[model samples]
Target: MFRNIVVGLSGGVDSAVAALLLKRKGFNVTAVFLRNWDTADETGKCLADEDYKDAEYISKKINIPLVEVNFVKEYWHEVFTYLLESYEGGYTPNPDIMCNKNIKFKKFYNFARENLKADAIATGHYARSSFGPYLEDYKPGAKVKLLHAVNQKKDQTFFLSQVSQESLQRCMFPLGEMMKTDVKKLAVEAGLGVIAQKPESMGICFIGTRTFQNFIPQYLENKPGNFINYETGEVVGQHQGIHCWTLGQGCRIAGSSEKLFVLRKDIKTNDIFVVPGTDHPALFSRILITSKPHWICEEPESLIDSWTVLNCEYRFQRNEKLCPCRVYKSSNNKLIIVSEKEKRAISPGQFVVLYLNDECLGSAPITHAGPSLHSLGEGEITSDVDDNDGLLRASTV
Candidate 1:
């Protein structure tokens, strides 16, 4: 039903192939290059200039008009600000999720419809939709399910869990059924061989080559704190900032050789608790509490029913395998998730994406993970987890 399409062409292999595929399908395709990072502040040179030049060449080769738009200010306000606040508050936020929600789907979607008069905005993401790759069955008031891409290794649906249903109905993922290797092969066949040779971009773009510790300090204050051993409650070391460490991440002590991992962040006390070794029980959490969920299409019927709890599959990180879990609705719209298995380093501030097989139900930002093996007694594994400060039965809470 829709024809005019604006593809996010970043000169990368995936996007080049995406634009090529849509253009071959006889749709009017426009390549949009988004400049989100401003390198003038510190780098002195424009880091994204090379990327734009490649995009220009790719668009010309594909015979599509290329338009460059600057969303540097929008990205800072929408994605970067949230990242700083989450870190300062002792949470490991997923800015990639927010980038899709606020910038790519929201800002870019709007720009395409308003400026370019496109019927839909397409992305190079390895994800699919129940409405078809081109959103052929999309309707104004109907719900659309976000399905996983056939290539699970390159699946990006987790990053799009917070996407609104409206934007989803107007979006297309051209790489849904294509593998990374296949995408590169197609790019090479399209005479865009250089694009296929480009290295895949990872993590936050503005940080570039700098380590997390090095780049974060430039924006956040250096509030030093003590690193206490969770088991001994003894000050093991000091850190420049609690924001620098995340749950389950490694911690190094000056002059000490024992490897330690983060257990918890006491934001009020300004202390980060650590335990020696990656296999420490103190690093595993069996239960997690989350903020309100944002369902892309509609609330699952069972969730909306009077049923107090329902079983589902969930994962915090994209690479982590989904775990069977019981979901409970707590007071104030919070969700209590009892993971069937002990999850290592379930950090607060992470977005927990829920799935029912291949379809993404929704996602919620993690607020707390608790009842670590260190705190629970042996028999409490099942009973104690259900009675955790009365939070165990979130449906009643």
Candidate 2:
């Protein structure tokens, strides 16, 4: 059994219960509250102070030592800047994924080991990792296997795919095998009533309850652009900035009763193309080309050789159906994925995580996507423009 442990206390019922469980298991557990983002919302309110207070209260209730660490500078440099740059370059980047890779796992792991003298670090994330036989050598302790949580509704493997193997090997997920309902029950039983009833946070970590459009302009200079109809190449309306919209998002296009959806953005021309309907052919694609892939364990040859059939899930949410696909290698060492069924809104800058059964293999950042030859029609609009400017950076994994 692990002797010394440090758990990230996020001031939520999940982490509160996690701390309780670890203490009960006879481990010397310490709780650390990470102040990652210190920015204020549009209303000039900061949520980090409230969260820190809750974390402190929970630590006293659970009779454990609590420490506070500020990672605002690290978050701004490693995660927030990347997020703004990706939007400016016309791609929707996931900052949560970046936060997990750079701060929670990388920076926090180092702090736990060096300062706290911890043998293992844990979190309330709804994902599991365990020592298992190597994928290549079949040797014990050769690899750490990442698996979905038992509560499928709360799986977080997608956000954690980019975390380094060294961090995962010493990591513990105390709530991985339990359901959310049970976690709340345990929190209440342990006298953590305030945490058990707190609502879960949504949207960007720093933005809190503010509108995304209002918050983004603070960092990125808005470049107004023309909204063009994808079918006829006619100017339908004008947008304040391309950064305000993302592909597949519904927008109120001028002079159209039917809702319009963003199909593509041409950064070079400063134009955003829109289609009439949500089911437009231009919005769906079967082929997705991505940056270099990051495999959690060993690189699977099946992805390069043979047909390499696999199942993919773009969004990490529960109840999302997996899309069957085959992986191939492009000439430039990028991954070319062909889905058996047409996938709607295969947005660039989003992650495409691959899985075999329950084990998460790895993921890659999508760079380009288009309809398969069979799905392409004569009148359908397609963006031939190259959008690889922002994707040239190395994978953070």
Give the whole-model CA lDDT for all candidates, comma-separated. 0.86, 0.78
lDDT of 2 at 186: 92
Residue-level lDDT for 44 in candidate 1: 64
> What is candidate 1's CA lDDT for residue 360?
91
What's model 1's lDDT at 375? 69
Count the clashes in each prediction.
0, 0
The TM-score of predicted model 1 comes to 0.95
Instruction: Please give the RMSD of candidate 2 to the true structure.
Output: 5.3
Residue 42 displacement (Å), model 2: 2.9
Residues 98-193, model 1: lDDT tens digits:
999999999999999999999999999999999888787776678889998999989999999999998898899989988898888888898999
Residue 18, model 1: Cα distance from true site in angstroms: 0.6
lDDT of prediction 1: 0.86
Write candidate 2's Cα lDDT for 163-184 as tens digits.
8888888888888889999999
